[model samples]
Target: MMNFHIHSTWSDGLYTPEIIVREAIKKKMEKIGFADHYQTTKVSSISKKYLKMYLEDIKALRKKYGEIEIYAGIEVDFSPRTNIDELPDFEDFDFVLFEYVQDSLWDGYPLWMLLDLRKRIKPPVILAHNDLSRNFGATDIEAFLRVLEADNIGIELNTNLNYTKLGEFYYRLATPIFERVEEYNIPISIGSDMHENLELLDDVEDALSFIQEMHLEKNLKLFLKEVGERYER
Candidate 1:
């Protein structure tokens, strides 16, 4: 299994990078990206300074740990786009992941603004999750999806989707967009987005099962082939 989006104690998560990578290696993950969240949206805050140590730690792990492939990345929101440049060499990382969750738990952002942000980001496996706005603003997500498709950004099929009333209904909500992406023959990556160590490997099967039941096997294979290559032993 491979997980490109993950968090550790460097951010709001519950473990250290070493522990996270250790567990990933134990679970036999082929490739994993430790993308801790960084601060964004401050009036004067120019960059995520906290990422310095995290990146260093991950890089050290990359050199020391030889069995698994570790990508040194930080998960930043699709806002505060100014900070992207503040980050050091993009070539150092295998890939990165981000989403459009600016408002409440809705997990979406303005498509036009997203398109604008895409122009600034250098290619590194750009991905967004389920399309739902927090303020309940009903916006057509096609605008952002189209731009992502055009720019060669791949969306993530996160298995940890919300399935309750309070939680945004991601699977059903994502059906149309997922179908649309498939119709366009765009690529996607599957992620556990594991916040904690255990949950890291917990939901891959469930997410795959949901998509399979929904009849997305071909899409799944295509997605795995693109993203899972790094995970192969």
Candidate 2:
């Protein structure tokens, strides 16, 4: 199994990167990525000075545990107060995750703004735990898919319970969007959004089932291929 939304002590998570690596290896995970918080908020974001250390720590873990693939990533909070322009360049990381891009309650920046920001960042950018069904359900599906394709961005299937509403996962609620993804062959990412729980390191059984139901094998294979290529470099 593969997951790319894990958080460790570098941010607000309870565990450290070493512990996370140990847990993922114990679970027999094929690959995992560390995406600690990078919010502009002073209390929530990782300090700028720690950024280099964070990447180096994950890279070291990647080498030590050659048995499993490990990636360095960050989860950026895109809100009205957060300036995508002022954010640090992320070209060196394996991937980047954006959260609350269209949630009004959280003062999220719109998808259009994110599309513009996507052009500046170098690594793969994914929308994290978004309620897309609520945010983009009424918009033009084709247009949305076009922007995603043009920007080379991926949508995340978050397996975290906090994103569930009406007793269904957010991804399930966003059927129209994903249907278009299938039609357009856009890449998709899966993240358990693990914060404090290492026991559920790669526990994404439900997400796996959903991917099969949606016939997203080709998309997933493409994503994995890109990740492998990035690692090779």
Candidate that scores best on TM-score: 2
RMSD of each: 4.7, 1.4
Alpha-carbon error at 141 in model 1, in Å? Answer: 7.2
TM-score of each predicted structure versus truth: 0.71, 0.95
lDDT of 1 by residue, 25-68 (tens): 88888777776665666222214564566667887888889998
Candidate 2 residue lDDT tens string, 135-219: 8888888988887878888888999988899789999998767766777656788888998877668778877888898888777
Candidate 1 residue spans exceeding 4 A from truth: 41-47, 79-91, 101-109, 132-145, 161-169, 210-233
CA shift of 225, model 2, Å: 2.0
Candidate 2: 10-residue stretch with minimal lDDT: 39-48
User: Candidate 2, residue 59: CA error in Å?
Assistant: 0.4
Model 1 pairs in collision: none
Model 2, runs deviating above 4 Å: none
lDDT of 1 at 43: 22
Error of 1 at 117 (Å): 2.4
Model 1 lDDT, residue 76, Cα: 55
